[model samples]
Target: MPVRFGRIAARMFLPKKHNPRLAVLLMIVATAFIAATTLFAKALGGDTLGPPLHPFQISHGRFVFAFIAIASAVAATRPQLTRPHWGLHFARTFFGWGGVTLMFASVAFIPLADATAIVFLNPVFGMILAIPLLGEKVGRIRWSAAAIALTGALLLLRPTPESFQIASLLALAAAMIMGVEIIFIKKLSGREAPIQVLLINNFLGVLIASVAVLAVWQMPTAAQWAVLIALGICMALAQACFVNAMARADASFVAPFSYGTLIFATLYDIAFFAQIPDWITLTGAGIILSGGLLLAWREARLRQLP
Candidate 1:
């Protein structure tokens, strides 16, 4: 019986075969799960906490939950907490937390689909930042794709007096910060374990957000508490899946799959809020999708070259 139990445990815990396709699929599922969480957050609203919560307040709850979940997971996994590159970790944490806060704020103002679409510019920004920060070279193909993606973003924003919202600017700021986070992650990729990076950033995020929440603390209703807990678990799981997927495949291969989140977000919006995007939003989304796919293809092709 002892031997049989040992064999069973080994089978369960041992690493499985590497499969890039499976990694891509997991990334898509994780993105969809994240999108669903946003829908849930929107539905729960500020009323989940007895009083109507502001958008930032709901975001604070979500971050608190994420912190608890991630901390627990780190304890269970016993990952190496020591980071050789503390500076990169700190940079990533500051930028990542800011981006997350801004994103949550935008979610409160804009539809989930639109908000997600705007933030999707992260990859484009990543590509641009990589050139200067990482000393990476960008070819003509990438530049063209970046231009096209920017145009799509402009279409979504419209920039006209009727369409302007300072909230959209917040989204853009978040995207830029997210780009900084990505660049820092790339810098730290091989130097530290992914779990370490995740844990540190989440820990810092919780700490920073906690200070903010304290200043604007409000009691949460039982239902809001449940929603926050659920969101935290989902966010941690999605992050884990994303890390695992990236470990298994190239970023260029996995990045395009992240776009699946937009589709899921749109469905979530329609189902929960009965919100259908107008033609302009739809057009912009389509263009962004096209540019993202093209960029991914270009990256994959370049990776295969010698």
Candidate 2:
């Protein structure tokens, strides 16, 4: 099922009206679902649920069930679709799959708070990537914001020899790869229906993840299976909410609110695993959030200019 080209195109490309209030609400909801997805991933990644699932297996389950969820939505809505841009879909799916796998891997070895905070660097990486990929110019304010965010990531890394976490590197790499995915996503945005994009992206993701997971795949216990399903459904919901939120309002208006994921993830960590955020986690996360908000403010300001 696909959405009508005319209606979706108009909403995506035409700046008819914007509802920042609704967008913020949707974004916050999306953050909760996203945090829940990671919480489930953490459960499956560690021994709490069962034998720790491989990152490949965890990500594969994510795509499989997420595709199932989106497919069900498409079946219900039955929107007419436009011709898809396959190249962009493949690029987006490839990086997205890789990023999520690495992210799952990272959370297994580090606190959810640190992993979530470090992955927040995706926006900064996206800004750097846009310079070459999208031919966007970055001024001093944007550069400073990126630097501040990166500094926060470094603090989370605990540069001291004894305290440093090797796993954080996985989260860093995930952020970079997801940043590249953002370039492809930006290319697709406004050119396709959000539902169609969701459908195709998840379909391709499942295929890619299935192939990769085969090498290390193992059977998940009953509890692990349930969490896997929950993880995928949450991811599907998160993607839908995020895309619809962007469709409703300016991204800069909605982007900063995505930081709600960090809050939710921290709370989940504490509630489920008693993993409290240390001073470094809280301080670094705050720094990263400040930089993200700064960048969002800069973007909003630039858009207002002629």
RMSD of each: 4.5, 4.0
- Model 2 CA deviation exceeding 4 Å by range: 1-19
Instruction: Tell me the lDDT of model 1 at 290.
Output: 80
| Worst ten in a row by lDDT for model 1 | 5-14
Q: What are the clashing pairs of model 1? A: 46-53, 49-221
Q: lDDT per prediction?
A: 0.74, 0.88
Candidate 2's error at 81, in angstroms?
A: 0.7
- Candidate 1: deviation at residue 12, Å? 11
Leading candidate by lDDT: 2
What TM-scores do the predictions have?
0.87, 0.92
Clashing pairs in 2: 2-79, 2-80, 3-79, 3-80
For candidate 2, write residues 1-306 as lDDT tens digits: 123322332342223257889888889999999999888888898898789999999999999988887777776556788999999999999999999999999998998889999999998999999999899999999999999999999999999989999999999999999999999988997898788898899999999999999899989999999999889878887887787788788777788899999999999999988988999999999999989889989989998999
**1-306 in candidate 1: lDDT tens per residue?**
323332332232224456799789879988987886676566555343466555556566666666666666555555555636767777887788788778777766678877788888887899999998889899998988888877887888778898876777777788888988889877887886666666677777777667777766778778777777777667766776777777677777787888899999999888877889888779888887887788889988987889
What TM value does model 1 have? Answer: 0.87
Candidate 2 Cα deviation (angstroms), residue 3? 17
